[model samples]
Target: MKTVAICSGKGGVGKTALACSIAAIIAGDQKRVLLFDGNLGLPNCDVYCGIEVGCTLGHIVRDGRELRDAVVPTKAGFDLISGGSGWKELAQLEGAEIDALVGDLMVLADTYDHVLIDCAPGVGNRVFPFLRASQGLMVVTTSEAASLMDGYALLKNAWDVNPSLTAGLVVNHVGSPAQGRGVASEVQGIVGQFLSQELEYWGSIRHDSLVARACAERRIFASAFPTAGPSQDLVDAANAIMGLGVEAEATEEISMLGRIKSVFGKKTEDSEDKAA
Candidate 1:
């Protein structure tokens, strides 16, 4: 399976909605898609999908439930493994907890063509593991200055954790596609010039009232408004992600990329070595 982590630096960037939209779009193509809510303490992908849930990843970890049994199929054409709403243990997972989660995640992800991980909105320890484990990372940001800076911080820290990470940027809630592309280009060029890491402009979504309406109505935005501009933008993103051509690295080895250093987040001293 090709695991793709979707994250942002701060909250309220519509990352969750975009993740569900992308999942539905990919699943629409007849590919098996699994939308894993990696947000830990505050998981709510089900809310966006407008689906009822019972057992979740939290049950799998906390109560020893089977991974297969915990999976819930959504009306949006994909499966969802949600996270607990306010599990403090889940929020502060470490050591064995994280390892077992990653192990189970990979095992569950094995049954699907794609896994869209809706990670917690930050660069904390809990979020980096998913970033390191995934074959690709998608950072969501708005056009605001602070949002762009925080998004860049997340990218820099992500590369520091996993040097092999291939990243992409998605400009969300833009006034126009050109505006979003410009924002994506600016961030992409900055990362290339400083960190020397490639951040592809995956795609961008416009500020559509339908998106908000879908969220308020507890429905999948793209399915509820397929012809909307933002939905088409999400479709473009899904196609770009499908065409990314993820490398066939062993998942276990990929999970171990920053196992030792990421907890403390120690960086290599030589910047040149990093850029290499």
Candidate 2:
């Protein structure tokens, strides 16, 4: 099973957005998907999945309930286990408590083809164990300098803990093409030179109002507005993960050659008409 933890150093940088979207795409393709909302202090994956939950990871951790009891199904053909709202218990969990939670998490992880863990912003003690346990870490960041710096800090900490941990970077809420490429290049350079971490280049998502609208409505953007740019970008991001060719019918954005031909085709047509 492929376990991926989606984390960003700073809050509100589209970590959950990218995690849920990738999970949905994998599920849509008939892969067994399990998503754990590790952002225990601020749980929103449950809301995004539209599952009303009476129990969550909080119950399992604080009340000594079984992890199976906290599993909640969602409309997107996957199970969501919430991290719980109150983090009092999580903040003070002992080494034994962390070991127990990790043991339970492994059982759930074994049941799916892919497990996506949505981590809260930062590299706190609570977040460290989960990041280490994951198969690989996917760091989500924006073009903002603060976000990149924090992401770097997380990468550094992860490296210090284990130099062999596999990691990839994803730039979120990218405003323009230039900005996206710039951020990607900057991250790749740093990871390559100093940390020597493997940086998988997942493409960027343009900032769109639809993402906010869908979030406010407690729905996923992919299902709510599949035709939107963000949705298409999500699809591409998933395809990249699987190392599969992207669908030609999904969006107008295509290979560089295809784009050039279309532009020249339009120019040629205009010139022909003027000559005629």
User: Please, what's the RMSD in Å of model 1?
Assistant: 11.6
On lDDT, the candidate that comes out on top is 1
Candidate 1, which segments miss by more than 4 Å at Cα? Answer: 246-276
Instruction: Give per-residue CA lDDT, model 2, range 1-62, as digits (tens).
Output: 76777888899897886777788888889988888988767878877766688888878887
**How would you encode candidate 1's per-residue C-alpha lDDT over 1-276 as one tens digit per residue?**
688899998899999999999999999999999998988879999899888788877667777777787789988789998885766667777866776787778987888999889998989788888877888889999999989999999999998888887788999999998999999988988998999888988888999899999999999999999999999999877987776564444555676776756644556545556899
Local distance difference test, per candidate?
0.86, 0.78
The alpha-carbon deviation from the true structure for residue 212 of candidate 2, after best TM-score superposition, in angstroms, is: 0.4
User: CA shift at 3, candidate 2, in angstroms?
Assistant: 0.7
RMSD of each: 11.6, 13.7
TM-score of 2: 0.83
